[model samples]
Target: MARKVIESVTCDACSKKGLEVPGTVNLTVMGDRYDLCDEHGARFRDQLAAALAPAVDAALSA
Candidate 1:
């Protein structure tokens, strides 16, 4: 018989229960791992992209 390992994770932004599946996005920022649900993960991704857009544009222009 084989044993299964389950990893329980919760969303860092909203503290909501996460799906805890292979497709879940686990983000490590500043040496801390944050688990996020689909909604919060999307929001975080969008915000991060928006924040980095200016720097990316500046670097490209330079």
Candidate 2:
């Protein structure tokens, strides 16, 4: 059993004063978590989808 921890995170894609959007997007890659704002979150989602599309298509075709 492993213990889970949750902490506040600032958006990694933006660098502006008071621009931190907490509790927005929590993305986990290879066991590491990243928090992003709405804009960056959407971009990340789209990029992830595009990256996975090829593998998904191949899997479906097989």
Candidate 3:
């Protein structure tokens, strides 16, 4: 068996990151791709949900 060496991966949000890709999420938005750490990814998702909440409520009411 042989081990392969790969480049170091860092959390897009972590300082002096020890984590790497294949571990982080690859999120694509508006034709742009971004690699984000777990915390950032969850934050983004929360923000998106919050931003859309008003619209969602309006649509539901209508």
Please tell me which predicted candidate would have the highest TM-score against the true structure: 2
For 1-62, candidate 1 gives per-residue lDDT tens digits of: 99999976666666534334333577788999887777777888999999999999999999
Better of 1 and 3 by TM-score: 1
lDDT tens digits, residue span 1-62, model 3: 99999876555655446544332766677998767777778888799899999999999999
Q: lDDT of each prediction vs. the true structure? A: 0.75, 0.81, 0.72
Instruction: Kindly report which residue stretches of model 3 are placed more than 4 angstroms away from their true locations once superposed.
Output: 1-9, 13-23
Angstrom error at residue 12, model 2? 1.8
Return the TM-score for candidate 2, rounded to 2 decimals. Answer: 0.70
lDDT of 1 at 5: 100
State in Å the error of residue 28, model 2. 0.4
Ranking by lDDT: 2, 1, 3
Question: Relative to the unseen true structure, what is the C-alpha lDDT of residue 14 in candidate 1, on a scale of 0 to 100?
Answer: 62
Q: What is the C-alpha RMSD of each candidate to the true structure, in Å?
A: 3.7, 6.9, 4.1
Clashing pairs in model 2, backbone N/Cα/C closer than 3 A: none
- Model 3: how far residue 16 lies from native, Å: 11
